[model samples]
Target: MKNEFKGLIVQGDKKFSIKNAKTDYTGGYNKEKAKDALVNSKIEIDHLQEKLYASGTYSLLIIFQAMDAAGKDSAIEHVMSGLNPQGCQVFSFKVPTSEEYEHDFLWRHYKALPERGRIGIHNRSHYENVLVCKVHPEYILSENIPGFTDIKKINKDFWKQRYQSIRNFEEHLTANGTVILKFFLNVSKDEQKQRFLDRIEDPTKNWKFSSGDIKERALWDDYMKAYEDAINETSTADSPWHIIPADKKWFARLAISEIIEDKLKSLNIKFPVLDELEQSKLAETKNILLTE
Candidate 1:
């Protein structure tokens, strides 16, 4: 983790209260500084990713979770600007399709994971099963889960079990050389309302506004508690969650890219070196080319 932004992390033994977390932090950086920082981080990431691909020893899985208008899309677009497309995979999860609903919640996500030496990004990930479904237990009925048709049965115990499943799933991934980083774009209700209004007022952004968004906004408190519980429950040492201050979109992108660079730097990945046999073969090939 970056030294300046270390306080934002809520993982393992760190207790979290979303109500107390900040919605805007620039980490002493102004807009110009933050933009410069983001660009530098992207450059570092480009070199690091090439080394990662050559080494092929590890993979990175980054998860983003947030309320509407929290800037998840923009953050991804900016922070990942210079990365090679072939080494990166981005998945945006919406409502589950019929086929997806037929399987375990983690099945599709597990299949979408990056192969060795690549990075996988989830705009909204498996956490949805616990967050959104926790907010609306009725949605669980659609999955046709055994003994879960009754909303009454979707009790505290059911959520605890889901959290356990997530922990186990991440544990399995980490043990197999996949590093996980989860981020929650913590935006304030006031800020969100302003953003929603901006969307409605601007003709270009009018399509972003939907009546369903307002319906979800009405349940903001419920969603907050759901996020609080999900973050506290699933965050582990290996798979940590960072509660990003997202009210300032530029700062959010800066912080995210910095954290990513910090993690990749920790890996100390390097390009592969040829062995003696390969070196001799290369020399022979060079001699043949020279003769030609």
Candidate 2:
């Protein structure tokens, strides 16, 4: 049934097209069915998170990337609401500061990674170096990396190196017990327009609307191309990208939750068990506590 959801996972060498992917995908899906599934998934997620926390053997890293008005914030909020805050950490990355730029692109992201028995959520993440910086290459000049004085000199090879860097970084993480789940919220341009309009019309949501978003919207095609290239380059058996349909926010949330739950389940995590000696000590401690 999960296979029926096309464009859900980007497999090997698949050249993804943002236009061909369906945003409002409700071919045979029912709202009630989705709601029920989401409810169950949330409960399972809460349970799995407890196991994950107690096992202290593996960590999960969830990465979300999308264009403006793609509902990244809402998706994280809804899907992760049930998880314990101590076990889950969320980081939203913006433009790099002078201090950040001094280090490598993935430096800050490395610092934010969750330890064993935890979940780390990257709202925007290190991919911004490839997506936003790819669209506007001039931003790279600000980094002042060695041997790149001219923005015009930064060509495809430059971005290619960045892609390789990202792939290597993710591979390293996966090799060391970090399970990576990358989600690209595939929101259509039309849906985004409606969302932007809603933000403008709703007085409370006006703060969410920014003029810069409109400017970025103009480069929708460019951004899509960048995303396509990045996903294609980085997706692997260890860490794959899921192009989630974000037109229907509910469906997106449900899908995200299911993926997360499934990944955690695959880990086969279990709480530590006490040995015979430890059990004996524990029983003695329990009897002492009862007497008290």
Candidate 3:
């Protein structure tokens, strides 16, 4: 099943198509089965994260990019609930503020990188510069890049530079022992409409609904093209992208947790081994405590 999920990985060697990606995939998995699998995956993730923290050699950066109401928040909450918060940092990138706008796009994101021995989760990350701003080029103007007084200057070369910048950024992190897992939650347009309707019809979820969401839905195709291009341009062997089938939240959560577990196991991190002196000290301390 995990290997099947690997099919969702956007291979840089191949031509990526967002339209062909699965959104409502269950792989014959029912909700109960997925939930049971998720429980096991979470337990393993907790143990693996402990090894990562105890070893303090590598960091894990999990990035989530998706359309509006595509379950990024819920996926983060559920799949990551088992992690030790002390060794985990989660940052949600909303619209950039005046201060964030002052620097290069990656500046704020770089500051949020997880230190070795921890897991960092970014909800809607640096990819937004390419995904959102690609659809609406005007947003790039707010960055105030010199020589870009007109939208005409923000042409193909400009986007190419941005994608290259992202690749360089991830490559540097991987070189420095940060394992990157990028997920693009693939939710069908019909599924998104149902979610929006749920948010509207249920009083408890009304806060989640916004008129802007409807406006964005109108540009679904544009966002898809942006996402397809962004994934193709940035995905690499080091920083892999998983296009999760997000229409079924349970399956998506299970798949993501399993993928994360697989990556962590591949790292083969273990608790730091103490030297002979430290080991003797542990024995002496235990003896003293027992005598007391």
Candidate 4:
């Protein structure tokens, strides 16, 4: 595993630093290069997953966070396309259900965690408690916490508390043999506008483009601030966030593949060795084949 944090911005004010950590992949969106990287990454991840499965130890959780039209879905699809379906699961978090709202915020997230030897992907995760909740406090009415007062102060305190809770939760998971990788797809405003326009122009994609999307776009600056704050507060050594430059989809996929592959490689997984009896039987089979 690469000990050096690849493409991470570790400096003053993680929130502000993350916003400025953008890169233009010199290779641009080359499908061939992207696909090759994806294939290699999947192979490495699969090998590690197999070893973990055999050992009955360690789970992997990958979280993807991005603004609307930031290629989160596409990145996951392309980067992990070659992985075995049985060894992986994907969870897309959405508006909380009545039952989910009844429990604490983290409870719902905890339930979806990956089991040992498996890889789990979260499309948008518990961070919503801070991101969307901070942007639109009206969303919290669904939570139905009694005597909710001072919405501004309450929201601020809630996010800070949530960040701490998330850190503790990740620590617990790590202690129990889980590796967590969090990613925030960083897309520029110009690129986002182009994507939105593409959605409007293409009939098949029109359904995905809701009028509410524009409303959200209007609050881009606010959301950006929220995202920066969330990433800064919660990004810890146990579960650090990778701020992926997503203006170019192919490059974004490539970068993600590299990160995942490196992490898997660090696990140092290998196929189980055969016993003496098994080795002798294999030698006999090889001799028979040679004679034939």
State in Å the error of residue 24, model 2. Answer: 1.4
lDDT of 3 by residue, 34-100 (tens): 9999999999999999999999999999999999889999999999998899999999999999999
TM-score to true structure, per model: 0.98, 0.97, 0.98, 0.86
Candidate 2, poorest ten consecutive residues by summed lDDT? 1-10
**TM match of model 3 to true structure:** 0.98
Return the TM-score for candidate 1, rounded to 2 decimals. Answer: 0.98
Clashing pairs in 3: none
Query: Could you tell me the lDDT of residue 46 within candidate 3?
Result: 97
RMSD for all candidates, in order, please: 1.0, 1.3, 1.0, 3.8
Looking at candidate 1, the ten consecutive residues that score lowest on lDDT are 1-10
Q: How accurate locally, in lDDT, is each candidate? A: 0.92, 0.90, 0.93, 0.80
Give candidate 1 regions above 4 Å deviation.
none
Name the 10 consecutive residues with the lowest summed lDDT in model 4: 4-13
**RMSD (Cα, Å) of model 3:** 1.0
Q: Write the per-residue lDDT of candidate 2 for residues 131-152, one digit (tens) a residue.
A: 9999999999988889888998
Per-residue lDDT tens digits of candidate 4, residues 1-292?
3333354533323444655667444244476867776677677766767776766577889999899999999998988887778878999998899899998888888999999888899999988888888888777767767756446546567667778887888889989988988888889888999999999999999987889888999999999888888888887766778877788887788778778877777777666788999999999999999999
